[model samples]
Target: MNDTQSVNATSSNDTMLVTKQVHEIEQFETFGGDIIKNVRVGWESYGELNDDKSNVILITHYFTGTSHAAGKYHPDDEEPGYWDSIIGPNKAIDTNRFFVISVDSLVNINAYDENVITTGPASINPDTGKPYGLSFPVVTMRDFVNVQKSVLASLGINKLYAVAGPSMGSMQAIEWASAYPDMVPRLISVIGTVKADGWTTATLEQWTTPIRLDKNWRGGAYYDQPPENFPNEGLAAALALVTQSALAPNFFNDVNAQLLAQADGKPDLYDIQQSPVIVQWLMERARGRTTSMDANHLLYLVRANQLFLTGMNDDIEQGLANIKAKTLFIPATQDQLLMPYHLERARDMLKANDKEVELVYLEGDLGHLEGLSGIAIHSETIRAFLAD
Candidate 1:
C-alpha cells in the first residue's frame, strides 16, 4: 500500500488527546451516484457505551464544526468544544448517564484542522493519486446520516437514545429520524428545517458565487498551488456574507451603535453601509476563518446543505410522516437562514400526520448562532426533553 492506504489503515479506536478518531469506509457509493473508493469519517466519543449499547446520544455538528464536541484538545486551549456547555458529566446531555458521539461531516471544511479527519476535495483519490477537487461527490443530509449509522454499527450500538444538533447539524438530526426512524427514538433539531426552500437554495448559491468567480478557484483544482494562490479572497468574501446572514439585524445594528458610541468624538459615518468599523470587523472575522478552511470543502458543504430534504425526495408531507422519533423543533426567533416559519410548517405537517412532535421557539438576539451561544439559557429545557 502507498501513503494514502497507510493513512486509511489507522484505527478509529485510537485516541489522541481530546481530538477525534477516524473510521475508514471502503468503496462507498454516494446519494448522487458518485463512487468514493475510500471515505474517512472523523468521530469522537465521550462517556462509555453501556453493556447493552442502548444509552447513546449522537451530537451532530453544525457547519464548520469538528467531531471534537466536548473536552479540550490541549490543557491550555482557550475554548472547549462548541457544545461543551451541554455535553459534559452533569450537563444537558449528561455524559455520565449517556454515551455521546460527534462526527465530522464528509466534506467538512475544517478537514485541514488537525482535530478533524474527513474525505473531501483535498483528500487524495486512491485511483488517480491526485486530489479529488471538484470530483468529490455532492452529498446530502441523508448521506451524512447513513455514514453515522456505520459509525454506530462499528461501536455495536443498535439504537440511539437521541440525536441532537444545531443548524447544519440539525439537518443531519432530522435526516437521521426520517431515514432511519427505527434507530433514533428522540431528535432535537435546533435552528434547522425539514427541507431547503427555494429562497434558502438561492441564498446558498449566492454564498458560493464569490468563490466561483475567484480566478484562483479554477473549478476547484487549485490545491496543488501555493497557499497564496488559492481562492482566499473569494472564501473570505463568502464567509463575510455568511456572517451577515447568521446574526440578527438588530443585533448587528446594536453592535454598530455601541461601536459608534465608543468613538464619541469621531465623526459619525452616518451611513451604516459604509461604516468602517463594521466592514473591518467582518473582514477580520472572514479572514480568520479562511486561515483554517479549505475553499473546495466549504463549497461542497454549502451544496450539501442546499440539497437537504427530509425524505431525500421532494415529498415533504410523506417525509414528515416518516419520522418516528419524538421530535423537538427549536427555532431561533431571530434566525434569518432557518426561519421560525420553516419549523412552524414542519410542526404543522407532523401534527397533521399524528407524529409526536413539539415546537419550541428560542427567543434570542444571536439569530442562527443562538443555537450555540444560547444553549446555557435553555439547558434545563433541553435536559428535560432529553430525559423525557
Candidate 2:
C-alpha cells in the first residue's frame, strides 16, 4: 500500500467520521540523526480556535491511541475516541470553552490500523522507494513535541492554554513543558511519570521479546515480503502481555475468580477453571489487535517509550526545574505498570524544585487503563484544575 492509503480499510463509511488532517514535514531530521525525507502526522481537532488562540488545549494520546480524540468516525461507530467522555461541548474538557486538538505521534502504532494516516516504519521511504521498516529513525518525546510544535505553528497557535495526556501522551506533555515551558501555561499528566524506571524498561523489553523471537519478524523488515511473512502470532502474544499489564492484577484475578465460580459444575472445558483460560482470553484479545497492528510499528513505539525521560539531558532535577507550567500528576492507585510510587517520586522532585505541582491518585480498578476508561471519576477534578 502507498503512504496515502488509509490503514483502516475496513471502515465502510464513505466519509470520515472525524476530521482527520495531515501535516507533512519535508527533510525532517530525528534526534537520533536519521533523516526522513517526508513526514506525515495525522491529526484531528474539536471546537474552534478563539481569535486570540488562547483557548487551545493540546491533547496528546497514549500508546495505541489515535488522533480521533472525541468524535465518532461514523454514526455507526461503536465508540468515539478514547477520551470521548471527558472531552466535548460542556464536557469535562469543555470543548465549548476551548479548542481541543490531538495529533498522532511520530510512528504512532495506530498508523498500522486501517483508515489512520501516519508516517512510520510502514511508510514508503523517499530515500529508498520502499518501507522504512527497521530503518525508521528512533524518536523521542522531544521529537513528538517538535512535530506538534510544527502542527501548532501551522495553525497559527503561538501559545497553548494547556497540554494534557495519559501514559505515553503524558510523557509528551512533560516534554512540552520542559522543551517550551513558556508556551504552555498548564499541564495534566495522567498515569505517567517523568522517567522510565528500571522496572518499566525491563517490562518493555519483555513486551518486545516475543516479536523479536518470531521467525517471521525478519529484523523488522517483514514488509518486503508477503503478508504471511509478518509476525502475527508474536505480535498477538506481545499485545496479550500488554493487556495483562494494562490492568490491575487484583481486579483481573477477582474477575477471573468470579467467572470461574459461575462456571462451577460445568464440563471440563466449559468450566473455564484453569489459569490457562484467562491466558487464552488475553491472547484472543491480542489476536484481534494483530489484524490492525503491525509488529514493527509496535516495536518502534516500545522503543520510544523505553527511552522516555523528562529533561533535555539525563538530569531529572534540572528538567523538573525548567518546567513553568502548573502541573497536575494523576497516578492510578492500582496501576502496576506505572505504579503510584513512580508518580510519588516525580511529585517529590517537582516539589523539591518548587515548581507549581499537584499530585492526585486515581482510585480505580482498571489500573493504567483507568487514565482513559475511568476519566469520568476524575472529570470534575480535571475541570477545576483547568479552570484554575
Residue 86 Cα positional deviation in candidate 2, in Å, after optimal superposition: 0.9
lDDT scores in order: 0.83, 0.82
Candidate 1 has an lDDT of 0.83
lDDT of 1 by residue, 28-88 (tens): 7888888888888788777777889888999898887877777776666787788888877
User: Over 4 Å off in model 1, which ranges?
Assistant: 1-17, 262-275
Q: Predict model 2's lDDT versus the native.
A: 0.82
Tell me each candidate's TM-score.
Answer: 0.92, 0.92
Where does candidate 1 have its weakest 10-residue lDDT segment? Answer: 1-10
TM-score of decoy 2? 0.92
Worst 10 residues of 2 by lDDT: 1-10
The CA lDDT at 208 in model 1 is 91
